[model samples]
Target: MTNPTALQLIARSNRLGADSRNTNYAGGNTSAKGSETDPVTGEPVELLWVKGSGGDLGTLTESGLAVLRLDRVRALPEVYPGVEREDEMVAAFDYCLHGKGGAAPSIDTAMHALVDAAHVDHLHPDSGIAFATAADGEQLTKDAFGGRVVWVPWRRPGFQLGLDIAAVKRDNPGAIGAILGGHGITAWGDTSEEAEANSLWIIETAAAHLAEHGHPEPFGSVIDGYEALPEDARRAKAAALAPVLRGLASTDHPVVGHFTDSDVVLDFVARAEHPRLAELGTSCPDHFLRTKVKPLVLDLPANASAEDSIARLRELHEAYRADYTAYYERGAAAARARGEEPPAMRGADPAIVLIPGVGMFSYGADKQTARVAGEFYVNAINVMRGAEAVSSYAPIDEAEKFRIEYWALEEAKLQRRPARKPLATRVALVTGAASGIGLATAKRLAAEGACVVIADLDLERAAAAAAEIGSSDVAVGVQANVTDEAAVQAAVDAALLAFGGLDLVVNNAGLSLSKSLLETTVADWDLQHNVMAKGSFLVSKAAAKVMIDQGLGGDIVYISSKNSVFAGPNNIAYSATKADQAHQVRLLAAELGEHGIKVNGINPDGVVRGSGIFAGGWGAKRAAVYGVPEEKLGEYYAQRTLLKREVLPENVANAVFVLCASDLDHTTGLHIPVDAGVAAAFLR
Candidate 1:
């Protein structure tokens, strides 16, 4: 039988979590306490069902809950060693499982169990946290809610913190909740409905109080030279700066990136107090965990040229890295003085970067994380605004933040994460990826854990192809005509903004014309060369600049043709363009070798199945030239090959993967033929 209490709890959680005003993503936990029939004793026992570790409330299910015997959890204080050893209490939770234990208990399990209520909600609402992190939080709590809510001073979350909250609740019988200083709020009631209502009341009252009494502009007047640039100009600047910032953030490891120019972010960055508030950092543990202690703020004006901004950013990054290292050392030294061993330094790169006019860029191990990090920073911005209006923004002390950031429990959680995929951190861009070989290559790279950009002339088809691959985190689509230099550069910029800088590029956009020298027009020749030859050069040239800026080696692959080497009749224009692409592989490999960039080519003959070129009448034209029907052309070509196998788009895609795979790390300037066995096309 289903537990109605548990169902109601989930419903309440989803409702509250759906609104970012209520809580940020995975930033809160909810629990219901009720009697359940114990399978072993066949008797009723009090049980606690709460959202488990690392689960988002909006998407939570039964499996995402941690089910434990309420009595056992409440009894934890009997054996609680002390605040210094409170982390040990988390492991003790395993012994209190009601059955198979639905999910791993979060560190907040004690907070849920110790509170004397049938239902409890602990959330990081922006309004609630505003008062909680204000300099005069205690007085603000008394002024806003009077006797309805109590104020608890800042204490790192642990069993001791849970005990402190329980004590406060017991002392204030009429109170509905308590606002934790330098954190968020905790609300409880006799039923799920009551608890949810109480939570909302606190959030709403805080917001209303600020609206009625607080100043109109909390961030201060807009500063000179910091006002937002026009929409088009700001976006162009963002696109230009994204790659350089990504490179800096990825100094320790490859990370995915996200960009935002929302009004909240733009307005905050343009304010006079932006630098001071950002330096104080976020207050809530959830906020700092994702956003880091603080961000790297770019000091350039809104109208600064991209070239000057780039140079200044490089200098800023070096200083940011040094400061981050010093912070780690200071924290480590403090921990050692207390006779405790601190966790190893994680990384010295800033997770978030702030630009006055361009907005914010956040980095993380993946796109979702990066996006969520940005979301959290927005929440922080809102908190700052509200706090400043009511009183003054006050975050936790630096040492406390360091302790929480490097806690042993947090380190253990990180170690338990699943291993990364083979190409987990790599990003790739594939041109003409709406169909055929280009699409196949994009999909394959995505499957191997690479973030991919699907570039094609048609935006609709390209977006559809990107959707077919996976979520926006894994793939994105862009409209780009390879012949246009600006469009090609924009596509590369999209890659930089979407998933950091590029590590691989596949130039597969081409059209075929099977016409003899006498039948071919000058326009036909120009079109072929423009798309197949000049297109590859343009995309490569633009990508190379970014790769060089990143200081990370990359791979460039040209999808040439077997006709480049073979003397096929009636294919004059295509064959000439293909030959040009073949030479590009050699030329780029030689030029880019010193930078550790590898250039290669794939030669495929008559890929009839899923071939965009063939579907565009190239197959019929070739069949007429060979004196055969269009449907028989594939079989006819296969019969001539030594392996007697028809070539396919997937075959060419596989060859691209092979050339770029780590196994071929030392190989360069190579072309692999995917023609089954074309003796004439075989490299000498």
Candidate 2:
């Protein structure tokens, strides 16, 4: 077989880059194993030539490469910091200096180093990255690549990243390369041209497959509207970021050095939004182990000094630590149950690099690793935006993520076991807990050993319901208008402060307004939306914040209605909101699944008795309309089901309990019916 020339290799790289562009962003990076020297000589050698940072593969020139002694590069992490810096970068350049001195190395050098193949190439092909960034990235990878490729969970690139890659290669001896979910692809070949060709092939395959499936362009850029900051503003931002970065990292293992005094860096930080800047960390889960998942936003008041910015950053850092500690604890319990050793404090501090004008640095083990992490984050933001375009981007509750992050094995173990007490020692917040399904679910969860927080608009009734449960696991009732963000957030804060964390949230607070589609008034529609749809969204958001911080995968159950699917007469408002509830569950399930959260909805048909709606004039009116005695209404509703049995509040509660407990580990984005088989045909 004829060896490919440089031009051929460049053409293949360009094709891969073109394939990547359809997904958004420039095509990803690529690298190849170059000629190696004799080890006996003890001289400089070139083992790999990896893509340099900020260079698109399609347009890459000979200079857009960085040759490093692969074995030496891998060994650098073991050396002390001082020695590694002086010895590695300079020694690696002795054999070949492909780029300018200041050029950043490709973020995926670690992965390439571990492959140890003759050639390696990695890229964030548009379709692949978009698919990888999805909640079901692993599953999607399986569907696309089948069982041939090695799939690595999202991890920050660096020493650990290399280790993970090595582990994969060791485990899967014949694996061609590894796929990093929520990030991109890694391919290896016997030669540089083969590596480049493999990458192009992978991209072409993914793009073609996704195109056939009608993949939407990953939500296009939304950052164009942000106005650039002024020079004065930029200076102030840099000055402010310097101290904050120092303070946050001063006591930690590594500290910032490169951009601390750079005006260019400061200008970039000042121009960036605080929230956006703080969020620039890696989007992948493994990145968190290297760089704590979130960054601290240092927002100084107008005319505030550097001291103020430092203080603010310190406060935020402390807050992040406190939240992480709490999350670790919650996740620890799950870990213990799974027979896994709890995470030791590895001195892994938050990845809060100072970006100066762009905001702050999203520090990882190194610049390349940080860049990859940032890419993951950017992908997540894009996914959120895209999902928002389709519908609301509701993520799974934080508690669920925490649980997954900490004790996914435990969750699995718990699932394997028979149902234990409904929610042993778990803390739950149940909205609309005063009546109907909410009250019954609260009682059931409390019976199962959960400390239930009953929140309802009716304080008196919520308290009464709490009293009825009478479990030591029950807490004082909290009156809350679920639609009110502050009120819901307060409830979440109280639960976290009081119980130290939360395990479940049942968003059952909702109202039904029956009206024909044409007759539905705007006020009536808004009222139903506010109470049912908006309330669930707000409460879930508040609960998820705590759960994610706690690192415990918590369950969130939205109380949808059968009308979500089978819309009925004079129930336009209720039906629409119910449909929204179902969609909300799916969105949350997708967004929060990686965090180990499982979101599901319950659609109870004709829940009889216990509901306030059935205890008043509305019940009598409904009974008369259906030609049944008011007292017989419950039975009549129950008989409407295929099972010819009434759907009681307890039945709804049981379904809710199943979700809140560990019984449904592999389940999410699902709708369980407690309506006695009314919707039997739709059953999976």
Compute each candidate's TM-score over C-alphas.
Answer: 0.97, 0.41
Report the poorest 10 consecutive residues by lDDT, candidate 2: 255-264
Residue range with the least summed lDDT across 10 consecutive positions in model 1: 418-427
C-alpha lDDT of all candidate models, in order: 0.91, 0.61
Query: What's the CA error at residue 260 for candidate 2, in Å?
Result: 41
Q: Please, what are the lDDT tens digits per residue for candidate 2 over residues 1-684? A: 211333444555666665424222344566666544445686645556666655667676656666565666666556524421332333343333422322446445666666667666666554445455556666656776776566787654444556677687778776666667656677778876667666666666665656665425333332332223455564445533533353344344432211222333333334423345335333433333334555555554334555565566667777777766775676667657756565454343455454333333444332233344444444444444332333333333344345334433323333454464546546689998888888888888877767788888988987888788873235547889987998887676555433335668998987765456797899989999999899999988877765564455679999898888875667788888999999999999999988777899998886658887667455775676678998998888777778889888899888888877666878999998777777642444
Name the top lDDT candidate: 1
Residue-pair clashes, model 1: 0
Query: In model 1, which regions exceed 4 Å deviation?
Result: none
**Best-matching candidate per TM-score:** 1
Mark the regions of model 2 whose C-alpha exceeds 4 Å error after superposition: 1-422, 471-473, 680-684
